[model samples]
Target: PTSVSSRVYVTIAAALVAQLHAAVATLKPFVWQWDSNDGAPAWLENAVRPAPAGAHNTPIGLLRRDPRTLSILWEDGHRDDFDVRDLRLACHCALCVEEMSGRKLRDPQTVRADVSPRQIVSVGNYAIGFDWNDGHNSGIHSFNDLRAMGERAAAQSVENV
Candidate 1:
């Protein structure tokens, strides 16, 4: 019943609406909540600062040892060794730690000494993910955190000496 030009305009309008919907869906994950109390975006509260110059957090190589151990060689000529049990205890995921309060939900005692990773995969350039033999896989351990652990271990060793 509509003229040809009107039908073409309606089709174009529908396509534009569809494109707008798609764009919103793609950007949904990046949308941040505005906090009225703090007058800042919610994501800004936990924004990670850039690492200082000459401070390397990237791992050059990761090696898994028998009986549940991981060795990470860093770009800064430092190597970090971790037992599977220690890795599990150090998980910083929301499931393991309460995001709001930063309270640990996972008890370290419950993670057995013999617990091993079923699989280890890189989450992205920033973190490594572990699927544990005990059926836990929610944690993504960032390179910065792993490096800090290594630094802490080194400090502890020096203190004990």
Candidate 2:
């Protein structure tokens, strides 16, 4: 009887050990090695790469808009001025453009000259989102894209002169 009881105890212990092993194995995917320095997880190190050169240098000082223009003062002392109408017309959101085909759905001519942003918000430190007075708000304009557009406009002005 003692030998039988010992066998039953061993079986229960083996089953518990197996269950613990299974639970650990199941949670292996969810377990992450945390880093102490930056407080980010080890798995996220490869997943989250550093932003591009100028990408991190977003508007530091001020982002302001008048009735006619939207202005961004970058961290690197670069000022970008965008015409309100031009900026509204350049919105590349799915509602404004076809996502797959990249065709413009919203008529550029339909946007009024007096068009302005009703609200502006930052998206994850990488992009700026705008809610236009015309009730269009799906667009998320990246800082990189905005800087490029500003540079392009500056080049065009120089060329015209």
Candidate 3:
């Protein structure tokens, strides 16, 4: 006697749990490297090498998300890549949710290279908050951010070229 809406919710809940399990299973510590796509130029990507560990005096280092693997790499050689799918489902941001207008930012790929985070601080167990270099840390983009950027690379490719 489950309503259609309830069934959908249950299915989504199960998927989210599975993704969380998968992300936890792959957690680790290591330095990460990523290959940029059209939106992000190769040179720009290379230029973004990890900063030194404890570089921020706040126990913070570079946070690089690999598009292919959704892995996170820190400058201090600590690495952990979460499930991109899950991260997208949990994108908690005013812009992403559009609480004011009841709209969602559909083009997560709009993230520009300039969106580089100036600093990163571990949030509660669920997320790592960011202070974007471009002052756009309001959106704590998870692995899904990387995929969106990669997918929109074609349109953003012009920036690279």
lDDT of each: 0.66, 0.63, 0.43
lDDT of 2 by residue, 1-118 (tens): 3699899999999999887543311001111111111221111111122334644345543334445766666644567788877888989988889999999998877998778766
For model 1, the stretches where C-alpha displacement exceeds 4 angstroms are: 1-55
> Across residues 1-161, which tens digit of lDDT does each residue of candidate 1 receive?
29999999999999998875433110011111111112211222121233236446856556554455677766545668887688899998888999999999988888877787666666656777777778888998888899999899899999999
The ten-residue window of minimal lDDT in model 1 covers: 24-33
Q: State the lDDT at 100 in candidate 1.
A: 96
- Best lDDT among the predictions, by candidate number: 1
Measured by TM-score, how close is model 2 to the native structure? 0.63
- Screening candidate 2 with a backbone cut-off below 3 angstroms (N, C-alpha, C), the clashing residue pairs are none
Q: Estimate each model's TM-score.
A: 0.65, 0.63, 0.31
lDDT by residue (115-157, candidate 3, tens digit) is 3434444443234554544445575654334334444544566
Give residue 138's lDDT in candidate 1 (0 to 100): 91
Residue 147, candidate 2: C-alpha displacement in angstroms: 0.6
lDDT against true structure, model 1: 0.66
- Cα lDDT of candidate 3 equals 0.43
